[model samples]
Target: LNHPKLSLCPSLIMTIAFAVRWRDPELVGPARKTPRETKRLSDIEDQAGLRWHVPFVLFYRGRGGDAGADAGDPAAAVRRALGEALVPYYPLAGRLREVEGRKLVVDCTGEGVFVEADADVRLAEVEAAGLTPPFPCMDQLLFDVEGSGGVLNCPLLLVQVTRLRCGGFVFALRLNHTMCDAVGIVQFMSAVGELARGLPAPTVAPAWSRETLDARSPPRPSFPHHEYDPVPPTPFPPPGDMVMRTFTFSPADVAAIKKGLPVQRGGKKATTFEALAALIWRARTAALEIPAGEDARLVVAAGVRGVRDLGLPAGYYGNACACTCRRCPPPGPCGASR
Candidate 1:
């Protein structure tokens, strides 16, 4: 481990200590009949395609209460936990391959990439330096991704564990978006963490029942779902440079905002997310000076998990979110005009 102390300046160097293939153990065998094979992507998943991988990094200070556990080789412990976790999430271990030029499917190859790295800076130093508007860089924190064909040819999953100078660590993960959503990411990561802590299995076991999300026979729609309406092909404009800024809202700030929203006659209130989203939407539209005569819409996605009528099991990990479009005139106070 390189222990040269450094600050979190632009010149800080992060080195890859080692890179290795972390495939499933021979004892776990192959991903043959596990519900992970050739599993069809739901409409939501299909729409996402394989254009990007969801990458996330978690920073932990010190040994994180584990004490003497995995004292000498924490990365090895994480790799072992990941290997065991992959047995249940075998699809993540697989590769995505195009089926017939028109569709894509998981190849179920049972392979992944694991990397260990060393950062010369302490976690506190990095935090004090302040991350930028577009999120912090994962350059040394994650394995460098290579471009392959139109869709990335990288492994379905890539993980990097970087040790900090202050005995802290960062666990970074890159997951293909086609196979998992935000919910699935949480589910998979939780499983790995549990196993790393010497637990037998994840608190919530993953289920690969993609068939439940299939389109109905004859595809009858009980109600109009304008959210999925097809738009006429139009000339595409060049993409604009986008900036993402993370905002932290304190409990008091959230409470104040919630208090400003009107309560329904029945005393019902909008959720914190709904209230904040409305405020943001209005602010953006007003700032952009959108025409009042134009129609504006808020596209919201709601998860259908635990809905009694869906008949989905508790462990189902496939796409379960449905989108709804609420349209309004592009003017007035926050477009809440009924």
Candidate 2:
């Protein structure tokens, strides 16, 4: 973002020299495509897409540095860990790319502003199953997180780990601004903890360069900021709509809600979020439970991103977000694993 040394690019501006050759297809005619080239487009177009700007994704992996986990020529551990970890990641190499390679994510995309985080956060996952390995990244994961959720452009990985003398690990992760917003970062770390323990990774492979307004090729023209804002104020289509609201709670109120048996009538270990959401759902259902003819629904927004690096595209300036429905049949009672 603000880094000077290793930051790749501050914005997506195509040099005049390069933009010159991009011809108006209607005026000059479509550029001739060889049979092989046409097939390549056909083959990958279904799966692969254009990302607008460059991005950087960093994943931190650490082993004890001493004669123990961090010790004893531990580079082997690094190699082994990366190998096994990325086993399901082969299709991702080219899948994640940049307009120009860089060490930091936002340097190239010219996509987002920087936000600072000083506190550590945590997230929990439930168990689920649908697809196994030997696959490309999922288009959507729990809460609709994507393997391609990094920015549409800047896709690189930054990883740092320190082996604690106490045999613990300290990791630092950095990424481009394109794929995820601030909250998505925390979800990613929690997902990583799960992955290290051999759990299923989140889904939500990002979609890129779908709109001309986002601009896949550059000389990146200046445009209205709201056009690229990921969450535009407009309402979602007929089937899905979103409302933003905030709740206030005092310490004692939260404590009472957690401890009161009435809150846990069914013997459930209700999480703060889950309990709160359930309360809202029940109250709302009771108030508006009677529909003239159909079932009611509750939806929750789920932030998404790749725990590992993804090659995205340039010209990407977006909010990088998706949602998952709570009512969707769960793999089990605990819900979905992200």
Highest-lDDT candidate: 1
Q: Which 10 consecutive positions of candidate 1 have the poorest summed lDDT? A: 22-31
lDDT of 1 by residue, 172-273 (tens): 887777777678788888988999998988889888777777778768889888677663343333457434567888889889998998886599888888
Root-mean-square deviation of every model: 5.9, 19.1
- Candidate 1, pairs of clashing residues: none
- Candidate 2's residue-wise lDDT over 1-338, tens digit each? 21211112111122111000111111111112211110011111222222322222222233434325523422233323333333322111222332333211222221111111111111110002111231111111101112323543322333333232333333434443333345434444444445555555434322333232222454454533322224313223354453434457677776677675343457766677866776666666555433433333455644323322333333222334433444422121223321
lDDT of 1: 0.67
Name model 2 segments beyond 4 Å from true: 1-75, 95-154, 174-255, 258-271, 274-338
lDDT of each: 0.67, 0.31
lDDT of 2 at 118: 13
Clashes of 1: 0
